[model samples]
Target chain A: MEPLFLEGKEDTPKIILNSQSNQYLISGRSLPEDATSFYSPVLKWLDEFSTQTVADPNVKFEVRLEYFNTASSKLLLDIFSKLEGLSENGKKVTVQWYYSEDDEDMLEAGEEYSELVDLKFEMKTY
Target chain B: MENNEILTKSMIYDLFKEMTKENITLLYQGDFSQNLMKAILGLTEKKMDNIEVSTNVKKKVFNVLVECVQNISKHSDESKEPPASKFTSILMLGSVNDQFIISTGNLIENKKVESFKSKILMINSLTSEGLKNLYKKIIVGHSLDEKGGIGLGLVHIARKTGEKFEYRFDKIDEQYSYFTLKVNISKIK
Candidate 1:
């Protein structure tokens, strides 16, 4: 499958998923006016990636969000749940949650997501 | 200048005096759209940048502010006997002592008051851990209304600050009631 690259904006995040590289990234702010619509394509890509039969089948999801609204938070949870499902299917799926050392809120948010999802999460600080 | 058009000295003096007494740092009372909301957030962001507080505290204030204003913009009553243009709301941010206060007021149908009040009471009654559990439950459930609200905003504000939320309703006629919600965040700790 081809990679998906979305540019970041003031109200949206940058999303990059490369099936060949087995690397996925979601970064920047996510406060879209209509989060569902804004994230639909990325969700679709995830769905397709889950069904694909890859050679190695190791995935690493990196999330580095400075800020996100409540709606975006729900969508993020959905994304994590999807990845958890992928992990349950015997694929090696890991998640890296990145936040600044001083951002306690973001750190706590990462911890909460880690607790909720069944995927392996590495809390990375910058 | 005509009497109505001319600036009355007493009115001007009284307004400043009232503002000083209330300690209001920023106040906006008018129609609230997405553009206006962004502008208000920008203004507050610039103002908050100059203050000596942690990024966590700033995030808390910003999150609480967004939720409060969005609640007003999305759920406020649009239909009333008096024809109130359907988009008017008020937001006030102030600081007293070592804490920051954000207050928002808007019109709402009298029928929906009980549910909102009960929900707020439930939120206020929960411990911080309980609120976290509730937040997790809501996120997992993933049932949002048309306006994208599953009461997550209120839950987040409550969890972020771990502070008591102050709210009240004033009767504005038979059909409409004005709802005001206030959230306080301490700068220290």
Candidate 2:
């Protein structure tokens, strides 16, 4: 599978999916006007990544969203749900959730995803 | 002569003057697009930078602002002819005595008012912990509709600001009503 890299915009996050490193990174603000459309390609790539790879890929997700709107929140959950499928397939999945030390809400958001999905989530503060 | 148009213009002018007198940081009333939203958020971010606010409080205000503006863009009535931009909405941010106020207004079908009122009221009734629990529960059990949201914006706003969502509805006609939502952010978060 080829790597996926999306540069961040003012209303969208930067996404980098490196199959070689088995590292997935998403960072910056996600407040796109059309959350569903903005996230569709990423979702499609993840779906393919989860099902197509034969061997268990050591997958890691680094999420550091400054702020995301409500619509983006649902898409975020979709991303987590797909990653959970990969984890269920016995692949090693680890997630690093980064937030500013002063931002409690972002930390709590990380905790929310951690509760929903069975993945190792490391809460890192900058 | 008391012309209706003249009266309306005077009313709007008075409100504009009041907003200016109150030291509004930003006020925009027009169609809302992704670019517009980004521009507004950028301006607010710059404004927040020069102010003396805790990082947490600034983050809370930014988050609430994002949710409110997007909520209007996603759900507001855009059926008016000669469609202005993409969605018609009003966004205002101001500070009064150190407390920041973020407000958004848009049109909605009259039939939706009751449900929205109930939702806001229920959200306002909850304690902070209750709001957090509701947010968690709703996120887990709820499904996103075609609108691409699980109805968590208000809950998150309530949780972030620890303030009641002050809202109002004005019946424009039998078909539609203008809705406004006001969120107050304290300096301490």
Candidate 3:
């Protein structure tokens, strides 16, 4: 499978999903004007990644977003739902959500996501 | 001719004076394209960086501002007068005492005013815990509307600001009304 790498922009987040390296990271700001269009490719990539066989049985996905708008919030839930599917298929999927020490909102966002999804979720403060 | 020029100059001066008196940091009125929205956010981010506030508050202001501006861009209706096909809106960001007030006004269809007002009222009626629960429920159950909105922007704003939304709707004509919304975010923890 091909690795997906998209550089972060002023309004979009950086994305890196590699099966061989086993490093799946999404970090930076996400407040695009058209979030649905911005995240369509990402959702497609994740959908493809879920259907394929991978080398690693255990996957740790890291999310370090500084801020994201409400539209992007919905998409993040979609991303987590995809991860949940992978977990149900017997892969050990863990989500490491990182937030700034002073950012209570981000921490709460991670907590809410954790409650909604069935996965090993960890909230870390930087 | 000289009197007309004098009147125009005085009008401009009065506008400046009013804005200054209000302590407006930014004011924009016109079309809100995607590029313009990004530029507005960038400009506000820079302005917010200089303010002596915690990072959390700044992020909250920025987040709320994004939702407000996007709301205008997404839902504001066009005036049916001279310019029949343009979305024109006004955004004003002012600092009052210890709070940052973000105000936006735009044209909206008269038929939708009731629903919009009720949405705000319902959101304002929720406590913090209730707002959080509603946000979770909506995010989980709701999908994007025809305009690409999941209807979570107001809920998110209410949750972040922890304040009631101030809004008004003035009838512009039989078809449309001018809608205004004001959201305040306190700098103090």
Residue-wise C-alpha lDDT for candidate 1, range A9-97, written one tens digit per residue: 86689999988887799999787656788888988998988888777767889999988888788889889988988876668888999
Ordering by DockQ:
3, 2, 1
**Cα lDDT tens digits for candidate 2, B1-189:** 567864677698887788789868687988677777778878988998999999888888888888887787778886554333243688989988869999888888888999999989999999988887888777667666633442588888888888898989987766777888888999865
In candidate 2 chain B, what residue range of length 10 has the lowest lDDT sum? B78-87
- Per-residue accuracy of model 2 over A1-126 as CA lDDT, tens digit each: 888999998778999987776669999989886788888998899888876664546776899888887778778888888888887776778888999998888998899888887778999997
> Which ranges in model 3 have alpha carbons more than 4 Å from their true place?
B1-7, B82-87, B146-150
Residue pairs with backbone overlap in model 2? none
TM-score of chain B of each: 0.90, 0.84, 0.90
lDDT of 3: 0.88
- Candidates in order, TM-scores: namely 0.92, 0.88, 0.94
* lDDT (tens digit, per residue) of candidate 3 on B26-125: 8899978868888988888898888899989999998998899888988898875843335479999999999999999998888999999988999999
Least well predicted 10-residue stretch by lDDT in candidate 1 chain B: B79-88
The model with the greater DockQ, 1 or 3, is 3
Compare the candidates by lDDT and give the number of the best one.
Answer: 3
Cα lDDT of model 1 by residue, B82-172, tens digit: 6544537889999998899999888888899999999899999999999999888888875656226738888988988889889999877
- lDDT value, residue B108 of candidate 1: 81
Across residues A29-121, which tens digit of lDDT does each residue of candidate 3 receive?
998877878888888888888888877778999999999998889889889999999976667899999999999999999999999998889
Give residue B115's lDDT in candidate 3 (0 to 100). 90
